[model samples]
Target: MKPSNTIKELLDILNSNRIGGVPVVDDKGQLVGMVSDGDVLRYLAPKPLGIAGLVYIIEEQ
Candidate 1:
């Protein structure tokens, strides 16, 4: 996937297929980066409540 992909397109691919992450590639398909579900959350969601969600956040890790 190119860095130019829209958020909607990335989410669509993950949601529709129930995936965790997608490898970002260039014209040659060489791995460049990864877009994970966590990365999406980190974008759409606000920063963790350091104290309140601490347990949940730690558990997630």
Candidate 2:
């Protein structure tokens, strides 16, 4: 997978391939790193103070 690929794209690949993770590559196709399902979930998960941050943002808006 490329670094610029979206989460949906990666998830699709993982699901279709029945894999747990994927290797992230650059434009040149060199392996840069790997991303697992856990990593993606963690990234998408809410932060500890997410509600407070959302409240502040709503008030600001």
Candidate 3:
């Protein structure tokens, strides 16, 4: 699959074919990388908010 493929497209391919993962290739059909459902889920998962700084709330005087 090419990098341009959308998330929905990838999911569709994986689901319709009942595949857990698929290989990504370049224009030459050379292997570039592999992507799995877990990877997709992780990427789509919300990122953590680490090291919260000062957050102040102001009130109407």
Candidate 4:
């Protein structure tokens, strides 16, 4: 797929019963990576930005 494709499209595909996790294949269909609902959720989990920033500042000081 083109890089311009949006995550919404991928989410639609996941929601549909037409396919399972999207096969992150190369141009030759060789599996390079894979994305599923769980994978997406894990990747999109809310991070603790405030705590992370505080830690970085403290370490630098």
Candidate 5:
């Protein structure tokens, strides 16, 4: 699929469905990347990648 797909369309399909993120795939359904609400928000946020803020990753004990 292409990025030209609207967020509204994605949300409509995502509703009543359970998945972590939307797999951005080529026409053959091969995954290119994923797009979750979290992914979108992160990109929109005022922070650089791999930088820590209110959220941080913790190694499992």
Candidate 6:
């Protein structure tokens, strides 16, 4: 897949092909890297705010 592909496009390719990951290529078609389903999931997953959330709450009061 091209490096410029969007997350949605990547997901579509993965799902349609029933694959876990795909190789990312540059404009010249050289292998740049690989993107796995786990990688995308981690990227899309909500990050924990932890202490930062508490600090924000305290400051707002």
Best by TM-score: 6
User: Model 3 over residues 8-60: C-alpha lDDT tens digits?
Assistant: 78889998999999999999999999998867665654464233311111111
| Cα lDDT of model 5 by residue, 15-46, tens digit | 54765467788777788887886765565564
Residue 56 lDDT in candidate 3: 14
For model 1, residues 31-60, the per-residue Cα lDDT tens digits are 889998778667755776655575665456
State each candidate's clash count.
Answer: 0, 0, 0, 0, 0, 0
Candidate 2 on 2-39: residue-level lDDT in tens? 99998889889988999999999998889999999867
Q: Which parts of model 5 have CA positions greater than 4 angstroms off?
A: 43-61
TM-score of 4: 0.53
Runs with alpha carbons beyond 4 Å of true place in candidate 1: 49-61
**Winner by lDDT between candidate 6 and candidate 1:** 6
* Clash pairs detected, candidate 4: none
Off by over 4 Å in 6: 46-61
Give TM per candidate.
0.70, 0.70, 0.71, 0.53, 0.50, 0.72
Error of 4 at 39 (Å): 1.2
CA lDDT of 54 in candidate 4? 52
What C-alpha lDDT do the candidate models reach, one value each?
0.78, 0.79, 0.72, 0.61, 0.61, 0.81
Against the true structure, candidate 1 reaches a TM-score of: 0.70
Candidate 3 has which clashing residue pairs, if any?
A: none
lDDT of 1: 0.78
